[model samples]
Target: MQEKIIDDKILEHMTLENVFKIINDNIFPLLNEKEKDFCRELQEFCIELHPKIDKNQDVYVLFPELGKRGYMQRINLWRDFMPYGMKSEILLATHLSCLDSQLELARLASGILCGNPTFQHGETDEILKVQDELMEGSKIGCIGITEPNRGSDAVNMTSTCRKSDDGSHVIYNAEKVFTTNGPKADYFATYAVYNQANPRGTMVQAMVSRDFKGQLITNRLKIPYVDRVHIAHTIMNEVEIPVNYILGDNGKGYTNLFDGLVPERLGIMGSGLGICWATLAYAIIYTNLRQQFGQNIINFQGVGFSLGDLLARTSSATALAFQAATSYDDNILFAEHPSKEAEKWIAGVSSQGKYLVSKLSADLTYTVQQQMGGISVTDNTDVQELSSTSYIEEVIGGARNIQLLIIQNALRRYSKLILS
Candidate 1:
């Protein structure tokens, strides 16, 4: 006996192409003409590339492909890519996540996590060269901030660095866990403190290159779900970095670290947005076609109402993400003298938005899975993969509690604003 095949039209409608159609219907109305065009190009590119990916292999192999299309990142001006800004970066993340969440994770680590610092703070020729390499995807990058014991307390780093006698070099002896893309990274945006007791005044950020002489060790972490994207535990012993490689020197590293967080959280929100949209779109299509009791499951009140509720929440979260991205672009990215007040407001709202959307991604995917039933767990669809990745959404960028803590501190500051 042979397995029965599903109808060709049903198979075609379930593809990423159809997913793009659903995504455009929901999201294009909110975008400007240029933004819509960018999304369309990304959609077409994703459609063409999706069939070529070997899911079992490392996603790093595809970096150059993204680089060729100027898709590695969009937060800052890379070359001649138009409409470059925070919103564009968010859109890039959204489409990339929809294409492959695992690849999006690695791309974020290499492009935004490492490349962003260079664009924001770099001045020297060497650092600019590093930027070009990263943007061009000739090299891979990762950030080292999290450690074995120091996770949430990022400011209080256990990793230590020292200045050489000539002051031309910074030496690091550090251990970093959860170093996404570390196993294959050519450039590392690593942070350390010269004085742990005075980290705020003595922290340093360096762009550590693999070609540099040092005992740099990276072992792939056992993150089974996102195996397509490497994560590692990296140990650096006396990694000597030239002063020119430093993106943030002395106390400036503290400020740079926090500055990077806003965009990082926003990027995560965009990825979460894609997860929400992709999973919901898949469920909508699946339920409408799957029949029970001689009728489509989507027509049943239970399935229909639940999906409707998820869609409403997903749309609301997307609006919040776009609103935040737009504000950041207008005030920070494009402003001659960026508004301090808007910066403060956006910093707080980033936490709020990240918190809401990350959790929503998980909830929406899980609920969609339940509404979708057993087929969702199979390889025939993307729902399970989305759900698996969504499970980690609340924990990355900053964990759920961390986002809440930031929001809580902001809430406490409201009294001061009220009195002033």
Candidate 2:
């Protein structure tokens, strides 16, 4: 059967024309008629002014935005206006990645996974202040789970948080590496082992304020592309915040930390989706323009088949990512104790979805570059951004190996459920 003619609208070469179509047709229409105008306005602003792709910026300039307050408020305005749905998630993520968006937002997305304004225990006010600052784009945020010894191995992490003698404060002492948005982050939803509490030395999640002294934050990991999104090393020398800074409760820190996995990965997946779209689009245009053997290179079976495979992968990833996002959006996930059923579903998608999408995106970007051959390798083309950034994401939130382990654990749980 022939595919619908409308599906071909996105195939227009090297343009945002198709992106506008998808947002209008597949995504925005899902909203009420009242929102159509908002979608229209957003499409206009994004097409002309999305900063990531259109702007050439240095890390120094970008980092300041994190310190500037009220920036996230503007971003959050749209986020709040949009109804929560898989379509909304997909559209926002896909669009953000297209423009090399404010990378700090991704970090905030991860921190939010811990708990947001409506969810945090007792410290809702502080979280709200930080969150408000983050949404306003003045204050940056980071998820401080990874340590120097065990990256993403949250279970075996070594940092510790101890209550002060007066029981009024939580003191943190540790060093963390690969802290995304760290140098600029005003607050870190950090995970550390809880000392002098039940289940002694149990890992707990807390909010570490940058305003507090006795902390070191530096841009130690200097890579090529993502410096604009600073990944720094953080050294906490008796960094202290009130016990209220603790997210959720002390012993349940890990569980609170777990809440973010699905959303965080979904956000990352969206960025990957946008990159895949751009990479594939660019390759399509490039191959058609460049000729070989008296015809455009796109006519060759080798090139054509590769492109077809990439399309298949991108489509499959879109389906999987949306399904994952929907699974998460179904539940508010604010309860101090989440149900096992929710945990199972969230675990399944966040781990497996992130692994599959990031890997596929990396592969697709690589294939697109190969079609262009030589120039793809040089920094001259945007393909370099897709190529390098995808690699960073593969290891970003969690490594491929860690994701595989989570997937394995989730499968094990599923098998027991089936047998029972």
lDDT of each: 0.89, 0.63
Highest TM-score: give the candidate number: 1
Show the lowest summed lDDT stretch of 10 residues, model 2. 69-78
- Report model 1's TM-score to 2 decimal places: 0.97
| True-structure lDDT of candidate 2 | 0.63
Q: Count the backbone clashes (under 3 Å) in each candidate.
A: 0, 14
Candidate 2 per-residue lDDT, tens place, 1-420, comes to: 122221233233445655456434544434456446645654665566433443345333433342332222221222344443444555555654655533433533433432242244434677666655555455566777777887765667777777789988878887788877777667777777775344333666777787875664655577665656666788887888786676745667766666556567766777777777767766776677677789988999999999989877887787777666655555533335556786667667777878888898789888888887765665444566667778887887689998998888767877878988
- Model 1: how far residue 45 lies from native, Å: 0.8
Q: How close is every model to the real structure, measured as TM-score? A: 0.97, 0.82
Stretches off by above 4 angstroms in model 1 are 1-9, 418-420
Per-residue accuracy of model 1 over 1-420 as CA lDDT, tens digit each: 023244455566788988888989988889999999999889999999999988767898899999998888999988997668889988999998889988888898899999999999999999999999999888999999999999999989989999999998999999999999999999999999999999899989999998887899999998876768788899999989999999998989999999999999999999999999999888888888888899989999999999999988988898888999999999989999999998998999999999999899888888888898877877677777787887777877889999999999978988999999
